[model samples]
Target: MDVLLAAAAEVIALQNVAMIALGLVIGIVIGAIPGLNVPLAVAIALPITFKLAPIAGIAMLVGIYKGGTYGGSISAVLINVPGTPAAAATAMDGSQLTRQGHAGKALRMSLYASIIGELVSDIVLIMLAVPIARFALKFGPVENFALGVFSLTLIAVLSEGNMLKGLSAGVLGVFLSTFGLDPLTGDARLAFGSQELSAGWSFIALVIGIFAVSEALSMVERRGAGPIERSRVRLSDAAHRLSREDWRHAAPAIARAAPIGVFIGAVPGLGSAISAYLNYGIARALSRRPERFGKGAIEGVAAAEAGNNSVTASTFIPMLTLGIPGDVITAIMLGAFMVHGLVPGPQLFRDNAPFVAAFFVLMLVTTALHLVIGRIGLGLFIQAVRVPNQVLYPVVLALSFTGVYVATNNLFDVGVMLGFGVLGYAMNKFGFPVAPLLIGFILGPIVEVGLRQSLIIARGDLTVFVRHPISAVFLVLGVVALVWAGAREWRGGAARGASAR
Candidate 1:
């Protein structure tokens, strides 16, 4: 009891509060942007957290996770396009509501559903994680190894429509992660004698480059086009108290999405995007208003918002219990934690229960803060849209550089930021997916470390990968994905050929 009391008291320190607020504000703004996301948000914040205590570092991250999830809705409601993939369902109704002159209502509905979802998931995380971690304690290296393979397989299966492209990105990401000073050995793998290269690539730098710079470059292209419009916050027929039908329609979708979010988030590498899509599909299958799903079904919005944010809270499970990241954003956070001399996984829970518990409380606080402060400030956010692009673009450009500077404290990172910005702009123009790149930068290290470790354990026997059950599973999955992606490409080509005929 004394320990618990001290833990609670320690978490309430002023510094932690400030970190939480800082993370929340940055997260919301970044997440609200069309292309920037939570992973990028976390990555950008990592270098800044170095000055803080571990508790403060994680607290700030917790805040970002919460705010970023809700922030995505801002773009969806006003623009008819989701700022985040999770907001896709929100856009169907949110944009429709805007067109109906009920923009404020749509925004309110999103906030309402999102807060409930976030709070509920946080409760589940607090209650569920310890037991799961305790169970994980019984597993030896083999079991842990199997679990990692399982995660790899699931991730591979869901990779971009191109299995090869997905694996290529993931494999590259893993390999890149291996570049820094080898953990087991003092030797550097790929450092080319440059002092800067010895630090290896900063994941946060990569994130800021790929996400922030990439997105800003793309936004710059649209700078002369126009400014984004945002909606004010108000309750109305569109977002007022849900009717009985709304509850009846929305419950099942929420029920389905919430558990899926928790379970997938518990897994090592899987994250929220699939949870969002899976929830949408579940909502469609169960809806009497199935045809209405793509047209503005509140249930669809409910499911997507809930599922996406649910993962935000739940993804911490593995990171806290297993020292493994649940997804890319968590990967960035994992790096930040390690950098600060905090070990994540089972020991973290035992040694830093109060801090972990505090973060859990802050997760709840994030939802509450969003509802209270965000609701009050909705009008202010809307007014932000009134700022002309000529002015807004310069501010954004300046901020992008500021973000780069914050990471490396080096002007050289600014150049990397610009390079990625141009590359991001080119990819966007060509319709290449940016998510894979973000995933690449985050996951690259993990795959590298795991593969190298596994090989060493097997005495450099490539056959050992097949001999091990868990490793074999992932290898087979990689092979299967290659086949599937090939078949898909072939069919797509055949269709194009037939069309030309």
Candidate 2:
């Protein structure tokens, strides 16, 4: 109890609070912009956070996670464009609500749902992470290796529409991860003889490149596009407020979807975007007035927002407890934690309880801050939604370049950013998803280290992966996941072919 209070006191400091608030505002702006996202914003801010205290820096990032998740809905509601991919499902009902002159209600409901989802997920994280970490502590290198492989298999599941493409990206990511010095041997495998390549590519540069720069380049393609017309919104009267009927509909949807989001978030690879779609679909299936769904059902917005926002804190479960990042944003956070000499895993709880407590406190505070900031800044964000691509794209491009240069003080990193950006752009053009590549890059070292250590311990017997029951289960699960996704993809293709006939 003393430790908890001390941690709380540490996090409540003015500097930390101010950082959190600033992050919320920045996240909202970035999320409201169509070409930017929370991951990109967090990546851009990574270099900036290097100078701050750990709690303050992490609090700021947490604020972005909370606010950005909600911010996406602003553009989704006010305009037809989903500022973030997670907001895509929200657009179905959000845009419809706007068309029906209920933009204010949709936006407000989105805010409320997001807050509720985040709070619930935070509670779950606090309750479950420590216990899960305790259990994971028993895992040996073999088990950890299997877990890493299982996580890689999830890339296929994450691909959803394109399993092969996802796997290919994952493989490429793993290959790129091998660029640095070999762990078992000092020999450089893929450094291409460049001295800097010996250290491998910077994660920050890759993040900015694949997400920020690539997105900016895509935005360039739509340079001539005009700002979307503002939706008519009523905010002054009781009519615009959430009515009893609205609450009645939304409460159940939020209840149902928040858990779905939590489940997806606690796992690896599956992200808020998938949760939002799943929750939206579930809500539609359960709704008595299903026909009103895409035409502007309040429940639809509630479910999608709740689901998307639920991922905010729950993604921390795997990251904090197991050292496995659940998504790209958490992957960046993983980097942040490591940079601060705060390694996450079972030992973190035992060694850094105070910091962990403070981090958790920050998570809860961020939710409240999100509500306050989101309400006060919603109008400004709505207006930002109307900013032209021509204007916004250049600013984002410059920021991406500057953020990378500022972080590394090396133009080489900036060049790497631009190169990865082009690579990302080409990948997107050719129907590849960037998430797998990022995940694979982040997890590659973990997988390699675990596997090599396990092999060494087992005297080079590969069967060690199967001898341990936990490891065996993971290996089996990975195979099953691959087969299931492959079968589904094949069936989907066959069905499409049949339809084409």
Candidate 3:
């Protein structure tokens, strides 16, 4: 009771509340801009937090994290360019909705889903952080390998009609990921004698290229073809508001994705990008009309936003309970904790119960603030789509290159971005799905590291994956999903052939 009272007193401070709001605004602006991601925002803000009180500093960072995660969906819906890597999944549907004149609806859904997901995950962190952290600790290399394989099977789902093209793109992504130095050996595998190649490709550069730059190229091509009618969001339009029916469709997806995000966040290394894609795949799989997924399904936006936003709060679970950073963002937050002389672990919780309680309160308060701010900004956010294509594309192009150089301080990365921009444009031209390639790239490292470690531990015995119950389950599920997807593709092909005959 004393702890609760103290926590309330700490969180109710005006400085803490103001700091949270400031961080959130900064986060949203950065996140909505193409090529500027959430981690960069956090990194930039880390220095400012050094001078504030511990609770106030940490609260501001938390606000940024939550806001940035949601902010990515804004540009994704408006421009078909994800502001963050995780928002790439949201772009699959949200972008389509923009083209279809439902940008307002998609934006609103993303906002609501983000708030709900963040709220649920924060509650979970407060209530079940320790237990969930303990459960996450059980995921060994073998289990992770199995999980990666299961995640890879999602490529088939994304591929659907173009199974061959999807698989090829996925394979290309895996091959690209292998170009970096070997994770275990530190020996360069595919550097091709270039010193710069030793570090492999920059993920940020690749993402900005494949999504933002490529979209700019497409916009240019569209301009050459002739004038195109762009979607405009009018305030009085019914499509701009979320109706009961839209909520009915999106609520189930949000409910399902929030927990998935929480679990993924509790486990170290599996970040928001993975959770976003996985939730999107799951939502499409369970939807009554799966065909609507890539064509502006409200549930798709909901799932992707919810899945990524939920990760924001749950990520703190491992850091707070086990002193383990869930991902790069939390790793930075861990530094903030240590800087404040608040070591996060079992001891810290016991020694500073009041502070811990206050932190949780602050998180909840941040979520409420996120909702209010997001709602107020919805009108302004949707206006991005109202810009002329010529102006918007050039600005986006300049920002894409500038952001990449600023983030990496390397000219080589800018070149890499341009190169991949061409690759992405060509892929789109050829009717290939880019999402699978991205999935493969993101999961390939995790799969490779886990497989190598498992093999080393088991003396090259592949059966070790099946020997562990958890790993075995994941493997079986992967195989089942692959086979099901193949069967569906085959049936669709056969039906097409029959109709042609």
Candidate 4:
């Protein structure tokens, strides 16, 4: 009871509240801009937090983390360009909804789902951190390999319409991911004798190229076409708001995704991008009208947003309970914790119970602030879709180039971005799905490293994956996912054939 009171006193301090608001605003702005991501925002704010009180400083960073995660969905809905890697999944449906003149509905769904997901995950983090972290600790290389395999099965699920093209794109992504130095050995695998190639492709540059630059190029082709006439939709004020029916469709998706996000966040290295895509695939697979996915399904936006945003709070679970960083963001937060002389292991919780309580309070407070600030900015954000195509595409092009250059400070990365932009444009022109390629790229390295390590540990015994119970479960799940997807696709094809006959 004394600890609760002490924590409450620190949390209610005006400085802490103000800093949280400031950080959230900064995060939302940076996150909404194409090419500027949350990690960069958090990194820029880290030094500034050095002078503030521990609770105040950490509160600001937490605010940024939560805000940035939600902010990515804004540009995704408006422009078909994801502001963050995780938002890529959101773009699959959010952008389509924009084209269909439901931008307001999509944006609101993203916001509401983000808030609910974050709130649920925060409560889970507070209540189950120790137990979850203990489970996370049990993940070894073999288990991780199985997990990666299960994640890769999502590519098959996503490639329902044309499995061949999807598999090819996924293979290309895995091949591209191999360009850097080998994980086991420091030696380069596919550098092709260029020093720049030795460092491999920059993830930020690739993302901006494939999504932003490619979309801009596609916009150029439609330059003569008039701007989107969103005003003609004649939506009433109530129509813009989420109805009970919308809740009925989206609530189950959010509920399903939140737990997936929390579990992924608790495990180190899985990251929000995987969670976002994984949840999206699962939601679509479970939906009665699976065809609606990738074509402006409200549930799609909710699942993606919820999956990514839920990672915001649960990511702290491992860091707080086991002193293990879940991703790059938590790694930076871990440094911030140490800077404040607040080590985050079990000892710190026992020694500074009041401070830990205070931090938890700050997280919940920041979540509420996220909702208010997001709601206030919704009107302004929706206007991005209202801009003229001729004007918007050019500006987006310049920003994509500028942001990439600023992020890497290297012309080579800019060149890489342009190169991939052409590649992405070609892929789109050929009716190929880009999502599978991205999934393969993101998971390929993890899969390779895990497989290699497991092999080494098990003396080249491939059965090591099935020998471990946790790993065996994931492997079985992967097989089940593949069989399910294949069967579903077959049934759909037969139904179509019968209709034609």
Q: Which of the two, 1 or 2, has more TM-score?
A: 2
Per-residue alpha-carbon lDDT of candidate 2 for residues 186-305, written as tens digits (9 for 90 to 100): 888788888888888876678667766775677677666565444532365463477889999999999999987886677666678767866775676567775577678999999999
TM-score of 2: 0.62
lDDT of each: 0.64, 0.79, 0.88, 0.87
What's the TM-score of every candidate structure? 0.60, 0.62, 0.96, 0.96
- The order of the candidates by TM-score, greatest first, is 4, 3, 2, 1
| Stretches > 4 Å off in candidate 2 | 1-118, 125-130, 160-163, 183-186, 230-366
Backbone clash total for model 4 is 0
Residue-level lDDT tens digits of model 4 in 1-501 = 788778878897899999999989998988888778888889889999999999989988998899999888988888887888899889989988888777888999999999998998889988898999999889888988899899899888888878889889988887888896787888987999878878788777888899888887887886675555645433345645678888888999999999999898888988889889888988887888877888888999999999999989999998999898989999999999999999988998998888899988888889898999999888778777667887888788888888788878889999999998998999999988888888888888889999999999999999999899999999999999999999988987798899999
Task: For candidate 3, give the lDDT.
Answer: 0.88
True-structure RMSD for candidate 2 = 7.9
Q: What ranges in model 1 sit over 4 Å off? A: 1-117, 135-186, 211-223, 228-308, 311-369, 372-379, 460-489
Q: Which is the winner by TM-score between candidate 2 and candidate 4?
A: 4
Regarding lDDT, does 1 or 2 come out ahead? 2
> Whose lDDT is higher: candidate 3's or candidate 4's?
3
User: In model 4, which regions exceed 4 Å deviation?
Assistant: 229-239
Give the alpha carbon lDDT tens digit for every residue of 9-117 in model 3: 8887899999999989988988887667788889889999999999989988988898899888888888777888899899989988887777889999999999999
